[model samples]
Target: MRKNSIKNTRINGEVQKELSTIIRNEIKDPRIHPMTSVMAVEVAPDLKTCRAYISVLGEKEAKEATIKGLNSAEGYIRRQLARNLNLRNTPEIRFILDESIEYGVNMSKLIDDVTKKDSNSHRQDEEQDEN
Candidate 1:
């Protein structure tokens, strides 16, 4: 029952930033579209594995291709991390599509539509109340 300290937050943020930059600059895979971005990284408590959530703005085929490309280059990515990060053991990286952003966008659109409908209904009620 302990809170995450500022130092821990900073460390996690640093790791995410490093991973994003490394993937963007170092990993040169044709299958990974330019629209793809590393959104976040969650490292396990023991630091043995890290789940990298990525957001790709493209068709389903493009997303699958990008994920496959990243999975295949996992070994090379781990080696690069070893050279850059001073860790006793580099964690294995797993790529996952971060759908939260997409979900948020969809939710926002739905909310807007609902709001408009409510406003129209309210106006009709007001007109009826006036009559």
Candidate 2:
């Protein structure tokens, strides 16, 4: 199947959803942070392997620990995924840390700060004009 074919897209969505649910509800590892989120999942066309992008809202140690925890629990997660989805091949799950969400948030804050400074300067300029 083509990488972006309709069927491939559907499989990616389904796998992403099921993986999210399994990680959030089934896994009980303490190393996996409570604020962990599965940001995205990409299943290869062959259905033999998958990449799960994860985001953890915590420090570096917590994020590392969460990945470690998930790696160790891969077998159980795969079993749960196979049971949940009736696919020809249950893809091997590989966890990857995604920082896009956090990056976007940081960029937004920077933009807001710049805009606030610009507006304040504009107000000062207006006052100086009036004076």
Candidate 3:
């Protein structure tokens, strides 16, 4: 029943790339953080709604302000989408905060702590064996 046989991944990727570029180059909101980057995009099967995960490299308030700015500019963004993309309908875009980058940093720190502990324990064992 698929018309084009295009996979969801491809469609999602295309939407993500185009939206990110459009947001970066076109949007001129002062509240938008300069470090804002589109982390991921999830488009519905019918391509009517898209959830865009964004990472703002700043404090909580900055992130909030950036989201508010994006929300306010959603109409303009959608219009830009219509101009850039050839889809029959422009999907409603929802901005979401992506904490995966922070989570990954935390996870890496935990791993480093574990690794340091393991190395220290190995050193102590070797010293004991020498004595």
Q: Which candidate is the best by lDDT?
A: 2
- TM-score of model number 2: 0.96
lDDT of 2 by residue, 1-131 (tens): 98899999999999889988988998999999999988888899999999999999989999999999999999999999999999999999999999999999999999999999999999999999999
Task: For candidate 1, give the lDDT.
Answer: 0.81
Clashing pairs in 1: none
Backbone clashes in model 2, listed as residue pairs: none
Q: What would the TM-scores of all predictions be? A: 0.82, 0.96, 0.86
Model 3 ranges with Cα > 4 A deviation: 1-7
lDDT of 1 by residue, 1-131 (tens): 11265644554566777777777888899998788788877776566888889898888899899999889988988888888777766888899998788889999999999999999999999999999
Error at 64, model 1, angstroms: 1.3
Residue 54 of model 1 has an lDDT of: 88
Stretches off by above 4 angstroms in model 1 are 1-11, 128-131
lDDT of 3: 0.88
Ranking by lDDT: 2, 3, 1
**Cα RMSD, each candidate:** 2.7, 0.9, 2.4
Winner on TM-score between 1 and 3 is 3
Greater-TM-score candidate between 2 and 3: 2
lDDT of 3 at 70: 95
